[model samples]
Target: MAMAALTAATTTATAAHVHGLCSSSSGFNGRKLSVALPRVCAPATSKRKRAGGVAVAKYGEKSIYFDLEDISNTTGAWDLYGSDTPSPYNPLQSKFFETFAKPFTKRGLLLKFLLLAGGGGLVYAGSNATGDILPIVRGPQQPPVLGPREKL
Candidate 1:
């Protein structure tokens, strides 16, 4: 991913579009650079059954692993991927992406990723059978009544 820098001193260039992660070095003096931004694309309204299914999607400095099942159902499915926290065990949520935009200022960055869950009961309508408009004209209506010819 590409990273671009923008100076806050200049009022004309207020925002900068970075392809990947944005950190403190991403901005100039006085300007504050933000890291990955959260972007939720879960269906605004859905009646689908939530389960223990988890999905992970990454974009720029943000790595999202969310599941509608975890939010809706009582399955108690937990997600601990791509976290900065360390664990005593070897298996722990690690930081896949990081952005240090600034120690104090946190702005000027955006990260977007979409996660869509299976929709609720889908209504599939049967296709209507349209009668053929033209009559079957290629083949003869009746089979040829062949007669056994005598030996020539």
Candidate 2:
């Protein structure tokens, strides 16, 4: 969906540019324009063809052209591990909370509690430290009234 929108925008901008309706200095109605067009980093090759018969611009292995079909075909995971098996530590899995709580269940209770308490204490201390540096507002002092037996 995003690719389609981008492609449509690029085509529209290219058309406008060709017709002299839009430019970097001035766009429609003499307004300044800042349309970002994709830059072609490499020369065109026959191997880099889109389903719509358009030659896509390439930056290394990636394609600059957008295609909706490509979105559904891939899992969107980077091949960091370079293996067929998925990584053991998947935060999005259903057992994520279980895995995360496994360590806290058996050991390090005191350390974790101390860390949490220390974090809270640091926050409170920071507020108190800043209070001394901030300015204090004072109201006008009233004049002292003299009593029958009192002398200045």
Candidate 3:
């Protein structure tokens, strides 16, 4: 009896909703279910104003205006970083490479040779240790047979 009343109320609510009317129906747990109707709203007006090619926007009581034509043209902009002039310090033009090259004097020659030889020895020792500890198989391996195969 309760189920029949609920079904009738749901049908009436659905019919009213289909005819563009807001209605309510009792849900399965006896809670009211509301149907929303479409509402008509007016279009919003722009708060911005234009004079010549410049656009002005108002924020609260303060108004700010900027020229649209000068936005893309950076000729009148200030040179903050001085990008037009050449920089005083350049990495490629500096004397940084001279330190790595062998000098005419024999000073520090032995130290440089010892450092290079020690680095190469350490790399070789690391490669051998890694290969021994983690032995990996390289190249194609034979696949395991799952079932008895017929003589082909």
Candidate 4:
């Protein structure tokens, strides 16, 4: 009974001491977090191409839909790219792309996994308190050089 009373008293004292120090509402509760940078691309007039019996733009590994008639009707569209007609593809480039481009795409999962494992190992070694662990796992140390004091 005494132990329960002491715990209750301590809890009440801690609560009272921390009263008014915390606010239930924060200013950032209603704000949104934006994680992407602004999108940038080439101008629309210089991005159209007519190939494989369709008017489309080369978007990554696939051709995307485009409106050639709309582009033709637009005033001053002919002034773009010095003549406004789509450029012709080189035969050698097209042959190489058709032969061996789809088989090799970039993959970085293994590199990311190795980096994550190394970071986790460093964190585990730092947090575990035992004998000397600095010699086996350590990073370069640069001593902080103090400069003259500021007058602020």
Top candidate (TM-score): 2
Q: For candidate 3, write residues 1-152 as lDDT tens digits.
A: 99998788777656656633433434346555565535668776675565567566663334534455565343445655457766587767556655655362466887788888999999999877743353244433555455556432
lDDT of 4 by residue, 12-111 (tens): 5454445353223223574432223335686787667755675666733455345455665534465664875554888888888966754334256556
TM-score, structure 2 vs. true: 0.21
Comparing 3 with 4 on lDDT, the higher-scoring candidate is: 3
Name the lDDT value of residue 64 in candidate 3.
30
Report the poorest 10 consecutive residues by lDDT, candidate 1: 112-121
Assess the local accuracy of residue 92 in candidate 1 as a C-alpha lDDT between 0 and 100: 28
- Segments in model 3 whose C-alpha atoms lie over 4 Å from true places: 1-105, 131-152
Off by over 4 Å in 1: 1-20, 34-40, 44-152
Q: Tens digit of lDDT per residue, candidate 2, span 73-112?
A: 3535456647887667866774878877676776588578
Candidates in order: C-alpha RMSD to true structure: 31.8, 20.0, 18.4, 24.4
TM-scores for all predictions:
0.13, 0.21, 0.18, 0.17
- Alpha carbon lDDT at 20, candidate 4: 58
lDDT over C-alpha atoms for residue 44 of model 2:
57
| lDDT: the better of candidates 1 and 4 | 4
Strongest candidate by lDDT? 2
lDDT tens digits by residue: candidate 1, 86-119: 5655332233222243322433222211111112
**lDDT accuracy of residue 137 in candidate 1:** 40
